[model samples]
Target: MKRTLVIGDIHGGFKALQQVFERANVTENDQLIFLGDYVDGWSESSQIIQFLIELSEKQECIFIKGNHDAFAEDWFSSRETPGVWLYNGGKKTVESYADYSPENLKLHLEFFQRMKNYYVDEENRLFIHAGYSSMHGPEREVYSSNYRWDRTLWETAVAMDKKLSRNSNLYPKRLLLYKEIFIGHTPTLHLGVKIPIMKANIWNLDTGAAFTGALSIMDVNTKEFWQSDPLPSLYPAERGRNK
Candidate 1:
């Protein structure tokens, strides 16, 4: 059977992305859901974006917009110079595209423009770049920014995992929205590791590929996972986020 692969934040690091793709053995038939943060960090953000664009043409790929990507959009639309985005490794992304022709620039910009805030599969599994609200059931209170900026949704899930007791049959209302929810943006390395973390029905997939961590991808339904070599090994001369 074909598989649905949910990938973590890339944060540039094209070499790391290549390694993970090889390890995962992804194919055109697979459904690939990228969590987000495709730009920033490392030095190959432009290349990575181009690779993804070509991949999307051949595969069932769902690209979710990330906060860093939002910053990139701002830069392009406003033709403004950098501020916080540069310090946050977005400089690398900008530098990567410094020499691109107008045609190439348009291609990359269109890809960003077409990205979605969140995605839900037929099985009701929610895929977002970051946290989301549970207060409103996809109606009024849902904020597009929540999909790229919030962390409480995942944080609460982690907390609930620790607080759940045998006597308690009730789960958090946020988790009730879907069978499973997958997200990226908050790297798992803050826990002193570089891997996907699971809490209740939520999965945190940003393994900090832009930092000292590795790129990760997993089968969303089966939970079979793959990772690249530690990012430092691939880009021996680069400094990651926390380096």
Candidate 2:
């Protein structure tokens, strides 16, 4: 049967991305939903973008825009790199594109431009890079940046009382907007876990591949997931975003 797989932040660990895809045995029959952060951190940021471009040509893929991706997009469009972004792994992304031709850089920029801030599937499952704040749902969100930068939605879900029933008046209305929400901006490592986490109906897929953790991919239906080796093991000489 065809499966729908949700992937977490890549953070430029192309090797980890490759390993997870191989371990997951991904096929053309699978529908892939990437939760962004495709660039930044490791040394192969440009290569990762090229790979995803090629992958999309052969498979069904939905790309969500992450905060890091937004920053990279701004740099690619304006050639102005933010100091904070550079400190947070954007420098590697710039270096990775050093050898690219203007035409190629423009192509990559277009790829970034094509990414969606959020995607809601036929089953009402929300796939977003970070989170949204509006209780009415992402579509009604007034602050567009919230889609790629907000953590309140996840925080609300995580802090919510597990015993609270869906019908409870105190239950967050944001969680009630969708059947299930899948996000990746906040790595599970912050919560002291190295795997995908589920709190309430939200799934946090970022396993901190930007630091010492692994890249992850999960079957949205079964919740069965696969991961790559910790990124540091894949690129021992790289500090990634650990600095």
Candidate 3:
């Protein structure tokens, strides 16, 4: 049986990662793909990155870049003020590597930079960090920003109820670009609130894990999904209003 496991935003949730594996009963034969945001929010950013790297070495693991991951990369790239890194979950990631030297940080940044924006299986099932819009372009020409910050672009695509053609730059006809696409970023529904988009055609496995939501995953071939209970809180309870 051909099996592929898609993991949602990790956000340094190592326990959640373990739970998902236990729930899915993942084995060596399974292919694992992470939707990004492996660091940030909770503790263990460095540990999680290293863990994921090791897993990648052993199996076919695909990594997508998320906004937080981008921030981490930017911090390492020396693109902005030193404090910028601390503001965007970089503190936790840095602490995770407290024992390492500057050289280690450089190496991790390199690894993050090489992570692909998306992955497409032979079946045409697209795995991306976030959704794309009609303004996107050819697979090779697709921009990383779309995967990192494209909720508005995808919202536009959803609003128009049409796939933006390749030539159309505002939004790339994402749906038309592939048979099916799996993405992270937006939380389909809050944890324990009876999500509105449960079991929809376009799978959203985020499950709001960064907030009170649980981490989720789905088997693309069978559409069999699994989620873990919410992990302990990292920040005080706060509600994020969605427009």
Which regions of candidate 3 fall more than 4 Å away from where they truly are?
A: 79-85, 135-143, 153-173, 190-201, 233-243
- For candidate 2, lDDT tens digit of each residue in 88-118? 9999999999999999999999999999989
Model 1 C-alpha lDDT per residue in residues 1-243, reported as the tens digit of each score: 699999999988888888888888877889999989988888899999999999988988999999999988787777675777888987788899899998988888889999998888899998889977755533343577877998888787766757674346676666777888899988898777677989888889998787888899999878889999988888788885543
Model 2 TM-score, 2 decimals: 0.99
Off by over 4 Å in 2: none
Q: 161 in model 2: Cα distance from truth in Å?
A: 1.0
Residue 8 miss distance in model 3 (angstroms): 0.7
State residue 10's C-alpha deviation in candidate 3, in Å: 0.9
Q: How accurate locally is residue 241 in candidate 1, as Cα lDDT from 0 to 100?
A: 58
The RMSD (Cα, Å) of candidate 1 is: 1.9
- Per-residue lDDT of 1-243 in model 3, one digit per residue for the tens? 547988888777777787888998887788888888887766767878877777877877788888788888876777453565566556666667678678877778888988888787898777788766543432644565777767753344345534544455653344556676677787765334423233213566677766667788788777787877774543334221111
- Ordered by lDDT, highest first, the candidates read 2, 1, 3
Which pairs clash in the backbone of model 1? none
